[model samples]
Target: MELYNWMVEPFQTGFQIRALLGGLLAAVMSSFVGVWLVLRGMSFFGDAFVHGVVPGIAAAVLFEFSPFLGAALAALVMVSLLELIHRTTSLKEDSAIGLLFVGMMALGVVLISRSDSFQGSLTAILFGDALGVSWADVQMQLLFVIGVGLMSLMLYRPLMSLSFSPDKSQALGMRPQLTHWLLLLMIAAAVIGSFQAVGTLLVLGLLIGPAAAAALITRTVPRMILTSLILGMISVTVGLIFSYHLGTAAGASMALVAILGFFLILTIRETVAAIVRRKRSTTLVEQGAS
Candidate 1:
């Protein structure tokens, strides 16, 4: 009974329910896009892209405009700059990512510093206020979730081919470049839709952690995605419950849970594999002795 109450208590209020809905929506979209990011080895690019949108979101906060538009425009600029640097310079993609990562984050701080409520606004933008989620926010996130899901499904073959062999994708007429751009767009959408719930800095946790954890035990992409969705939801639920009981920041709690969950899954998987190896070795020795 106490355990049941503990599970039910955090979501007793309207704001709490909204927070759960928002987090779930964020998880759904992030999971759909995140699997591909992991497969394509673009985790660094995804991190930079998340930070890349901060200036736009900060500007929107200061100028009283829609954050979604600001984030979208910033995403376009980030990708364009990344592509230009790759095409025009001898520097590697990682180098370009590092440059934009620092530059965009610093720019965001500078922009946020201009606000009258600089500290408050910055905190909210960086850490998020999970309890402050509104129904309107939930509605917007739902649309993003649907769009991401559809795109992910549509581009699965191209993305899979690109991940394994870009040359093969090109040979197959998959248009690897266009598929790559669409994946970037999906990542941006997930980050933009989720930042309000988990913040841009922390949204990467949900974006990567769940999918990474799922990768540990799952071999197939479909199973990995399903496992990631389950893990993401668990992280959100457990994080919120802990936040309510322990007086923690909801978004930070959730992000932390997602990351910790990854390590836990890793530990368990490794331990199980070791035990199995040991058992097999022991059995072989016994058979040899006999």
Candidate 2:
């Protein structure tokens, strides 16, 4: 009975229920978009996209506007700016990403430094307030996840091609530039939708961690995405449980769990590979000696 209560007590509250739902939606949404970022080697872009929205969100808070709108608008501008700078200047993609990421984050700090409202909300913005998530927030998360999933289904083949081979995709008339922009838009949408659940600073953890873990174990794109989604869900659930029992921050806990999952998988994969190599060497040596 005590064990049952321990398992079921945290979920008896409305806020906890809402937080769980929000986390689940965030998990699903991040998995779909994150797998592509991992395959494209654009995890840095995803991180930049996450931080790039901070200024917009801070401005929105100051002016009493929608954080999601501000984040989306800012993210689009950042993506366009990255493309523009990369195209016109001698700067590389990583250089542009670093410049924009640090500049925007610093700008956000400056903007927030002037406003008391931002000061109060700063922790929530950076690490999230999962306990404060409302049912409306969950609904929004659900809609975004569904929309992202539909887009992934519709654009799977082209997006996959673009991730695996952009030059070949362009040669096949897939319009690599347009697909690239679309991916940027997808990343922006994901970040905006997720900021409330995991915050901007930790959003990259949810976005990259599960997909990276799945990549080590899966050979195909679809399987990788599915496995990432499952792993993400597990992370959310386990993190929520830990947060409830230990009174830890829910968003950070979730992100940390996802990252831990990635490292755990990586370690297991490396160990397995090493064991296989050792066994193969031993077998060859024995055969030669015999």
Model 1's TM-score against the true structure: 0.99
TM values, all candidates = 0.99, 0.95
Q: List the residue pairs that clash in candidate 2.
A: none
lDDT by residue (tens digit), candidate 2, 142-249: 888888888888778789889879899988888888888777777887788888988888888889999999999999999999999999999988888889999999
The local distance difference test score of each candidate is: 0.93, 0.88
lDDT of 1 by residue, 1-290 (tens): 99999999999999999999988888888899888899889999999999999999999999999999989988898899999999999999999999999999899999999999999889888888889999999999999999999999999899989998999999999999999989988998999999989899888999999999999989899999999999999998999999999999999999999999999999999999999999999999999999
What C-alpha root-mean-square deviation, in Å, does candidate 1 show against the real structure? 0.7
Maximum-TM-score candidate: 1
